[model samples]
Target: MTAASRGILRVVDSDAAEAERNADARSESQSAKDTAQLVELSKSGDREAFDRLVRVTHRDAYALALRLTGNAEDARDVVQDAYLRAYKGIDRFRGDAQFSTWLYRIVANCSNTHLSRRQRQRHDTLSIHTELIDTRPEHDPALQGDRAELRVRLDEAIRKLPERLRSVVVLRDVYDLPHEAIAAELGISVTAAKVRLHRARRRLREQVLPMPGEVPRP
Candidate 1:
């Protein structure tokens, strides 16, 4: 072979070797290895392994659901439903992403489904948080109490937002997902995600924090 052709072949081989090394490194990471083992076991009908997987991820799932649904009962229901779906779908799971990421997507889908059903049924008219927020004395001196009150108000404000706006806000702001990722997860265009996020923020600010020159409610 000519010297020029030999050099090009060596460079291509070097790139391939580097790529293989990187892939190996990723596959060997402790978390990835453990997740792979758990996934394999779960796929083989090992109920205990699947339970462990759910246990590790349930808190995060519940937190996401709570943000999306704004009601503890609804959030619990969504998480439970998501877990049941996951258990059924585990064998079909592809390892292209972390199990947690896949699970979060399921939770997001379930959250969206629950919100849609609630809106359709008009069953979200009564908010359980109302009494909780109303009875908390605004003058509570404890720092922790003030923070708790603020959280409740913020959550209530989010809960009252329109469903589309609420989903965008919770996924982007509460969950800290980037706009593009949020779009993909929610199955919307990136531009739509940004617009929804902007609207959601505006609504949240108007409701949770008073606008300039507006009197604050007691």
Candidate 2:
């Protein structure tokens, strides 16, 4: 390369390196600030600070609830219920874990309670399946019919998953929670969380992938 070209390349590389370092530093600083401020505000009974926390964490919380409940309305209800409980119990928060971690625990507990109540109600009524199927949206005629068909297939696959495996897979894959956070939320050991997640993924693969003699069509 010419001397001028070499000089330009060196400058570009140095600039890129500096930019990456700055980004890393900024990320660390933001993390520290969020943690410190949240802890202080929560301890001081600052409702607005807690509201800010909700605004930041709500999307992830809702997504996790959606995956667990497998329905938008139920998920919304679960998240709302969880947040209410959290608000009432904030003073009891010991700060032993990250605030998000504590929130996840509340979310999980709320979802579980909702699901248990649903199961009990279903057992008492013969019309439970009718009610669930009735809640599903009608497909629009503008879309290809296959889109609706595929959605039904995917929902069935998820519904077939065992509870423990489903929870891990939903939290890890669907909500993108870290394994450690998932374990803490679920009150399981990290190794157990990993194993459950592995099994859940394997089961999902088996359901999605074609078996021998069943070639997947494009």
* Index of the highest-TM-score prediction: 1
Q: Give TM-scores for every candidate, taking all chains together and pairing residue i with residue i.
A: 0.65, 0.62
lDDT by residue (148-190, candidate 2, tens digit) is: 6656655555566655677888777865678887787667899
lDDT of model 2 at position 169: 84
Question: RMSD of each candidate?
Answer: 12.9, 8.6
Name the top lDDT candidate. Answer: 1
What TM-score does candidate 2 reach? 0.62
For candidate 1, give the lDDT of residue 155. Answer: 79
Each candidate's lDDT (Cα)? 0.78, 0.72
Clashes of each: 0, 0
Candidate 1 C-alpha lDDT tens digits along 163-190: 7888888887877666876787677899
